[model samples]
Target: MNLETFTLFNFWSSPLLATTAEAESSSLILAGVLLSLAVIYLASKAGGELCARINLPPVLGELVFGVMVGVSVLHLLMFAEAGEDGSHSLIMNLLQATSPMGSTTFSHVFEAQSEVLSVLAEIGVVVLLFEIGLESDLKELLKVGIQSTVVAVIGVITPFVLGTTGLMLLFGTPAIPAIFAGAALTATSIGITAKVLAEMQRLNTREGQIIVGAAVIDDVLGIIVLAVVAGLARDGQVVVSDVVYLVISAAAFFIGAIWIGRLLNPLFVQLVNHMRTRGQVLLSALFFALILSYISATIHLEAILGAFAAGLVLAETEKREELQRQVAPVADVLMPVFFVIVGARTDISVLNPFVPENREGLIMASFLIVVAIVGKVLTGLGVFGQPGINRLAIGVGMVPRGEVGLVFAAIGAATGALSDALNAAIIVMVILTTFLAPPLLRWAFSLSEESATTDPASLSGNISEPVLVESERLQSELVKPEIQ
Candidate 1:
């Protein structure tokens, strides 16, 4: 070695300090992270398979598995997510049992490891919204026309107003948390509904078309609501002007980005066309999403919105199908992490009714569950001039909140906007609604099928056969693992 290098090395590695403590700490953190990931993957896959076998959305499996390994159960994974203390991580407990880590150093490692996993979960969600954006075909709504728009608007307004007002008046929930939960109620898990319709051979029916179109619109609207609520939730309190500004800003940002992105599509396509490297389209799309995520974060909106807008923009290009194909593997790798983390962070023990203190939360959860169902069920009444339309089926189709609801729950929890009882309440609503919708939708259709055939005029809405033929190609694809 050179004289200077030898002297410096000797100084740091004398008999007093032959070992690199920083390197050792880094190794411990890495080891802990790797072990946690292995557990998550195993649990997620097992849970996913079980859920899929039962004809349920596999994403449900991920959340259930997460709960099994999380704060309320096995404790294999833990985080500071939504007020959870990183120091309570059972992964850290295992690491300490296996290794000779000092208590102070162990605390540092656990906190650092938790931070890393939390960031990974954030990235996981961003990728999710990106993929969801790719799947959303706004043109499909063209065939369903104003009726679907009516359903979407009514679906959003009804639940939001009822849930928010009820929480404020009945439960005395703070405005921000109440609003966040209410906005969450506005989401429709179209994926679950889509699968049910396809299985029943009713995917192209008038009610199915309206449900699919409305669900897509609400998902779009739900993403916007998430952005605004997240922004308000972060500030710790909501103000009138701030709320108005966030609403306007989020709407403008999405519409403006899509508009500008369309104008620049040819240029984007040209850039991709000129590239000869591996993953040209996938990499470009991600680059665009990440850049937009950064811009959204800078402007006080959630980064997921930017990622979503990126997906929306790129989806308009000629490479949509290929881009979608390429995006799945990446999502498969990351999306489960986000779901698992949300489930792990959720402490459902608060929902137990036996405990005196827990009774209030349980009561609140019951209230939320009621509102979640009735609010969406009311949406069916919004459709005008379609007497043959199965309004009950349309309402039932919008019932499941699925992953989109969890997105709100996760964000609210992470921001500390939701109390433990409220978080548990939201989770209960999500799980039950997701489970209830598919079967309920089938029942709605079954009850209406005979009438549909008897009333020749009833089977037809403003929908044309040709438009529905094209829309079928879009509706038949159910919500995938991430968003359903």
Candidate 2:
């Protein structure tokens, strides 16, 4: 339906109309929705099981299952019977429902699927971030210290070089675009790595500490780089003063937020502790997150960074353990929906070969994907000190580019620094990174199977122990503490 004529209830159109022909179409559409959800649910569970069977992370399975249920493979399977002849068969009927949005055969079914996917995916992201926030411990991350700095530096440098250089070579002389592309690849999604380590029982070890430290550093540095690149893309030249201020300002926000939280931590906890209902605590904490997020956005930084920082500050409070625990289940349900939506938003047909006109966009997308992967892989070398440090794990961890990358790409597209093809390419790259990491991590962790089940060798050299400690902290923070 056209945007102008659409109403929210239009989404609730009856799948089964009164006329026989229309009723069949409606029935098929309803059946299709149920089928899709059932498949996704089963696939996700199967994927998780497959991961355990193969000694890989369950998330890898989840992603693969998503893709299978996605338009890419599943839809293709559903449509396969439409070959050669304009035949009449059940397979052909199935194909109609699975076709892209414009297919006359099953437009309603496709639209409903798309809408469901979007809502779920958005919910997934929010919950994922919230859960990550819930798991974080301010005191522990602070204690991570110099190692985190070094890891962050190495992580930022490697990807910046690889991403920019690769892009510049492929698309000659628009240095600023190249820089933005590279900057987009540099941020690390610690949640993925931490989850993998937790699964492998390595989170408490020294290696886990380094990973956590490096991830925090990478995140902070990544934003600063994005800010600078964003500024350059908006204006033809790099603004030195603006860049300096952005960096300094971001640093100050983090430092200041944590400092204030430390001071207010006790009082906030005491207030929440006295509340009769637990919702009061959750509402108050969420309020803190929102205010921080708003202030950060005002300073031209991503609100998520503020939210994350706020969570860290709260991590030091006496109620830190209780607060995290209470918030976790809410996050768990919401987060998966977000991921599903991410997959649904992706219009795979946009990268079509049949549409000769859009081929340029496809080629551009292919190039960006290459740069995105290589750039992050190069960042793997950032894991220093321990010879045993899983460089592959670090590299894979840096792979997925989520909100941070999208913001940069969107800005680039909006400012005309990037053409339509290039913008699409960046988005494709982000999706690829998000999709690829879980499997890669599972494989990397599996490679060290012998070591995973063993005891820690030493503090700095031990990857397993640190991962365990981190997970435990996450559990304590997210799962409510036992009441007296």
- The local distance difference test score of model 1 is 0.79
Q: What is the C-alpha RMSD of each candidate to the true structure, in Å?
A: 10.7, 12.2
* Count of clashes, each model: 1, 28
* lDDT tens readout by residue for model 1, 25-128: 78889998898888888888998899778866566677778889988899889775355545567788777778778776787788778888888888987887
What is the RMSD of candidate 1?
Answer: 10.7
TM-score of each candidate structure, all chains considered together: 0.73, 0.67
Lowest summed lDDT window (length 10), candidate 1: 136-145
Which regions of candidate 1 are displaced past 4 Å?
Answer: 1-19, 82-88, 141-153, 164-238, 384-484
Winner by TM-score: 1
Over 1-484, each residue of candidate 2 has an lDDT whose tens digit, in order, gives 7775576445444432336555565666566555655555666677778878986777666656665655555542131211212122233356464643234545554444445544454445434544455566555666655656766786678767876787678667378777777777677766556556656666545556567667756776876787677778877667788778878887888789878877888889888878897488778887888788778779876565667677777766767677777777665555444444344334456666788756776776676677667666665565556666667665666667654566677777777777666676777777777777777766665666656556365534676778889999988886675642
Which stretches in model 2 have alpha-carbon errors above 4 Å? Answer: 1-127, 170-173, 190-205, 350-371, 386-388, 451-484
For each candidate, the alpha-carbon lDDT, in order, equals 0.79, 0.63
